[model samples]
Target: MISLSKSIRWLFCLLLTLAAAFPAPAISAAAAEPLALGSSEFYYLAGHMEVLKDPSRSMDFKKALEAYGRGEFLPLPGTLNAGYGRNAYWIHFTLKRGVAFPEKSMLSLSPSYTNSVKVYVQRQGRSPLLPSSFSPVLLGSDVPVAERPVLNPNFVIPLDLQADEPVEVFVRVYSKGSISLTGQVATYGSLRNSTYYSIMIQFGYLGIAAVLCVMNLIFFFAIRDRLLLYLVLYVFTVLVNNLAVSGMSTLLFPNHAHLISDYMVYMGIGAQVLVFSEFSYHLFHDFAGLWLLRYIRFMSVVGVLTIISVSLGFYASVVPFALIGIIILITMLLLTSKKLLVSMPQSGIFITVAFGISMLGYFFQIFRLIGIIPLEPGWEINMVEPATLVHMVLISIALSERFRITERQLADASRLSEKRAVEIAEDMTGELRENKERLEVALAAEHLSAERQNQFLTMLSHEYRTPLAIIQGNLDILAINSENGGEEESQELQKMRRAVARLVDVMDVSLMQNRMLDLQVVGTSTIICADEFIRQQVDAVRWMWPERSFTLHSELVEESVFGEAPLLNTALFNILDNAQKYSPCDTAIEIRTWADGDFVMISVSNGIAGISIGDSESLFDKYRRGACSHDTSGAGVGLWLVRKIIEEHGGTVKMNSAAHGRISVGLAIPVERGETPYCQKK
Candidate 1:
């Protein structure tokens, strides 16, 4: 008996060890309560669903059944978000029909971009072990519309449920992109209505995109803006992507449904990234050295590589790249918009709002894609389309604003150019008028010279004074009108005033030359006090040049000269004027008058320090000016006339160079005796 007990204990210990090594398959927990299909039009199945991931992508119906019995399927509320991978998902749910439930209903899965979907339905009391007990339905983007269990954009399976009887449903989904799934059970009528609404919404978005594309193309042709061209291409890629994601491409090209579903969707993503990067680069080209541009260029390269990968049938590999590209895109948009807002407020407002909407939509989608926001049935109404629609509209408005601003700047420049042209024309007109007056005076002088010399001189003086008065009057009016003008205008007015002064000086020189041409004294001589005459001339010249200094030294003893008063006045005035013109402004002019034994002596002296001196006698010749006189305005006839008039009055004129580069001109006239009436003849 002891040996038998010891043997039993050893056997039991061996049995316990075997049981630890290989335990029995665990019985799955009771399935969640079946959902009751009532009078409601639609029911969300996510809350009542269970999900199991098949990473190997080789799980069949038999394996799925065995796994469900062992409770390998986990309860999934809301929806399934199996991120980017080549993974398959199995979803299980049970539904019971209430008294008011429809006999025939539809089981729908979204967002309709899934590559493959298979639905299996098993009626109550059906044998769980027999494959024939479960009816299978094939649907998805990869399945042709005609081959699908129902004619709908999304995957739909028809279900016929018995009253108060529970029906078991299982769905298998596989995708090369993000694997996000949500489902609903609805009456056939409800499913039809919902599907039609969804199609209408998607088509409406496409129509808006098409319209925007056409409008931007027209703008591009009209304005030749490259930014608009990039925008058009970007929008076109988005439209193509929408068509693929919305299942319209599969219906339109039924024979190539697999190609459209597999390649076109990812290709569209890459193409959009490429084109949008170009658009952004051009839009912010003004900021040439921005760091964001480098990143955008990198994204463009990634986009191209993604397209290449998709073309090479690396669909699964391209998905992660696409997600990374999207994240970069969102980052670029936000950062660029912020920069634009600070740089250009008017246009930036529209751009910021547009990018903000787009970013929000993309953020929501990406969060759902990465399982941050659980997928819900409401996700079927994609925010991207609506947000993109508003975004595109705002961006178009921004482009329009830029166009308007450019036009306004151009118009302002044109107006400024026209104003300048008018001012130049007015100046030319004034010059022509002055020249016409000068020509008339010359013609009149020629005609009168043949008749009488004095008559010609009279006409010359009158005609010259008339034009001078007119010019001075106009200049005064212009100066008053431009009192509040800019500095440039004020400077222009000063130039005109100087030109008028120069014209008056030329007239004076011409008249003096004509008077000296006769060389015959026509007026009677008069007794004039030398000191008084010199003082009067000095006072007159001081008024003309208020800024110059003049010093006078007189030691005359009641001495008088017999000569024409006008002729003597002209000679003294010419001497003083020459001194003022050649000397620097800050220097002083010295005039001396003294009585000598047989004549009254007069001298005018001024500093000509840096002037190049030639023969001083040649300065008395007509039209002979000093070397330093280039910057001063003169016809060089003043000293010649002075010499002639002094000689006619029985006086001698001599030029003398004094110390320190001072130049002096001396005039010695015979004093009058017994009041003899002298007719100074040349």
Candidate 2:
């Protein structure tokens, strides 16, 4: 009797299952019917839904249908999220005809990270309540690129609807990485268009990543900055990870699709986290404390572990470690901001705001994965992509700020150095001025002593001249009285008189030369005719030496000269006297004067015996005598005095010597501007 009861209960359960599977026609039809709209319409499935999980992945469509009939399937959750797992997730939805949408529609499952996806569609006319009634189609990253209905990186399934018919769809998704299944329904044409634009945006993401990577790399090389170097590594790893996740790498590297698998994607993520953590640690080194340092080290270890696990084909295990690293990075950033607030509040506030905005897209994605944020259908917004760009921009700004601060410090140091140099230069300049003034004072004292010596010599010469003149007078009386003595005694008296006269001449010439050497004691000045002056000197020399002849020549112009007339007469007399003394007593003394240029020139030539042309250089030096003047009875002051006086009057004197015993002394004095007639004719 218990066996019979068990049989009856089994039959009852079977009948109940059968009844649920095949409801009454009207009710079944109504249950299968989707919302009715116009022809060729497109819409998301908005009716009752069902979802199933296949942990074992052994269940077929028949069992899945049976599970749905038994109410084992739950209402459609926000998304089909399996997290990072190997389990397959199935989502089921029913759609009815909607407002006219041209052409057949398509279903898209985003994002493209899923390893494999299978889509099934059932029409109401084909036993829609049964899973066996559905036709299955496949699209996913694992599906061969050439076999896809739409050749796009993301999954797209085609859907065709008949008039007034309800349609149902089931999507199964599985992946070795994080499983995110967001389903979207739209016209096939619209989906293609969306796919085109999506590709363009993905390329944009790639372009931005590439450009920023290159830019930061340039800065890294230029500045040798540790932060910039790590930043470039982080950006490059992140870009590779994003490409793998987006499945674009599969299309780009079709020949090497196996090489760019989910393992590499996760590996890249680990590397990105590792580099980024290092960057953060270095950037905030000034403000970080012990705990923060330890936290960074811990994260770095985890990041390394994640990379090892992913590389060893343990991507599933590395997901959690990657998550832990992310959490630590975020914590470190927040704490760093707090520390910066105490030291640099303004910069801290700005950085905090920037980090907050940049982190939005990243956290939102995480929230969506954990079901903390609802999954959005249609084109999934990648908050992380734009957020990453913003973060990179913020990093650049921070680097620039650091450079600016450094430059300002260097500029300050440079200015201080320049100021010190200028101060030293000024001190040296003052010392040099003092030294120059002392040298000038010493020079003035020495010059004064020389003038005193010259004055004493002039006084001594005058005193000797008086005594010598008296001796000459005594000699004249002796000569007259000696006429009574023998010829020998008379000759001795003549010789003594000549000796006395020569001594007197030497003393006079020496005194005059000494006075002329003193620049402060110049001859008294007056207007004098140069031609008449020459004649007076010539006539005086003629009277002194009657044994010597003289020739006085003149070419007078309507020109005058201002000077000490007596001194000039003395200079001319000395020249003529020397001409007669040095030459044969019978040789003619030639004195000629003429106007040459702005001055009147005088030439005094005499026949000298053996003077060379080269001897003219030392002819005017003090105490210097011409080579042939040794036999002459006069001091060498004759030509030297003429030169000094003419030079003082802004004129010149030069000596010319020739062969054949011919020598000439030329003198020129500048003519005065005021016109005057010659007072004495030639």
Give a tens-digit lDDT track for model 2, residues 195-266.
688778888898988998999899889889888888898888878877867768767876555456565577
lDDT of 1 by residue, 1-682 (tens): 1232343465457435544653432324545567899989999886677888898999999899889888888777557777677779998888899989888888888877887888889965797556677898887776767787666677778888899988888889887677878888999889889877877888889999999999999999999999999988988888888888887775567677765675667788788778877887888777434555676787788788877877686756765766656655654565556667777778889988988788777656655565556676666666667777887889899998988888998999999999999999999999999999999999899877755866666788888899889989998877766765642346556656756664565465446445567668376767876667677678767766879999998887567787776777778878888888878788999998888888999999998843445658888888888766777777887788889889998899999887777889899998877653332221
* Global lDDT scores for all candidate models: 0.77, 0.68
* Model 1 worst lDDT run, 10 consecutive residues: 673-682
**Root-mean-square deviation per candidate:** 24.2, 21.0
The TM-scores of all predictions, comma-separated, are: 0.58, 0.54
In Å, residue 484's CA in model 2 sits off its true spot by 86
Error of 2 at 27 (Å): 24
